[model samples]
Target: MIEIKGLHKYYGNHHVLKDINLDIGEPGIYAILGPNGSGKSTLLKSIIGLVNPRQGTISVNGISVAGTHAYRNEISYLPQIARFPDNLRVFELIRLIKEIRNEEADESELVNLFQVESDIRKRLRNLSGGTRQKVNMILGFLFDTPYLILDEPTISLDPVSLTKFRKIISEKKEQGKIIIYTTHIMNLVEELSDHIILLLEGRIIFKGGLKDIYGKTGSSSLENAISMLVDKNGK
Candidate 1:
């Protein structure tokens, strides 16, 4: 389980997160949604210990994120932008990450799933944007971890790839892994998320199941409910 208490973060004079208290105890897909600059990325980073909070505590399965690096072993993160050594070939990058993490990985399944097997010999600089994104996905899921955090993971993916991505996420959820991700695609949220955390001005304005959000906003669709929330809050 993940526990957050009194979480607050600041960037100079700007407050990015404010008094965030959340408890995630179940294994399912959680969609973090907010408009630009709402601290969605910051919140995710805070969980992964990439960003430190000014005053707060974050723990994963009873392990504190502060002043510790061991907890990261249980986490697999996919950033919004994946930057790798351009000179390295796809397979080389995979082998390097495996060697760095020192963990057994079933990357062949992922590589086959993403249909990147043919390009494994190509250098990172030569792959197309979509292909690179596929590679990013493959790396992110290559390791079997208890927690997965993906930021803008569907970016640059085609419809067929997107479908495969969804299937992979669903399979992970079924395996009892905690999946936390941020995406602007409401249909994807409606289709995949078991719960939604709506952030506004660095605060969680709404946190509940999809039906609960619709009921609260009196909107029929997830997109409309989000727009209504934004309008209601004047954000």
Candidate 2:
């Protein structure tokens, strides 16, 4: 379970996350939806210990995230933007990550799934944006952790790759892992998310299942529902 209580965050004088509280105990896909600068990424980063909150606490599986590195080992995070050493090859980077984590990995399966086996020998700077995104996906999934966090995961993915990505995510969910992701793609959210957390101006305006959101907004599609929320909030 991921527990977040009274969380608050700030950047200089600007507050980002304010009095946030959530309990994600179920093993399913949870989509975090919000407009830009609504504190979605900040919230996710705080859970992963990449960002520090000014108040409150976050814990995963009863382990507190405050001032600890062990809790992070249970999480696999895919950031919105991934930067790697330009001189390193794809396989080298993968090997380096495995060594750093000092854990067994079956990245070869992911390489084959993403059709990036041939590109593994290529240098990082040589891969295209979409190809790099595929590599990023492989790296994120290689660890097979219980908690997965993805940010804009479909960026630069081709239709075929996107389909594969969805299948992989579904497979992980079937294994009873807790999955949380942030995406602007409503269709993907509608198709995969079992629950939704809608944030507005650093606060969660709505948090519930897809059916609940639809009922509240009186909209048939996820995109329109979110639009209604934004319009109602004057965002």
- Quote each prediction's TM-score: 0.97, 0.98
| lDDT (0 to 1) per candidate | 0.93, 0.92
lDDT of 1: 0.93
Show model 1 residue runs off by greater than 4 Å. none
Query: Taking the tens digit of each residue's C-alpha lDDT, what string does model 1 give over 1-235?
Result: 9999999999998999999999988999999999988999999999999998999999999988899989888999999888888999999999999999889887888888889989999999999999999999988898889999999899999999999999999999999999999999999999999999999999998999999998999888999999889778863
User: Candidate 2, clashing residue pairs?
Assistant: none
Clashing pairs in 1: none
- Candidate with maximal TM-score: 2
Best candidate according to lDDT: 1
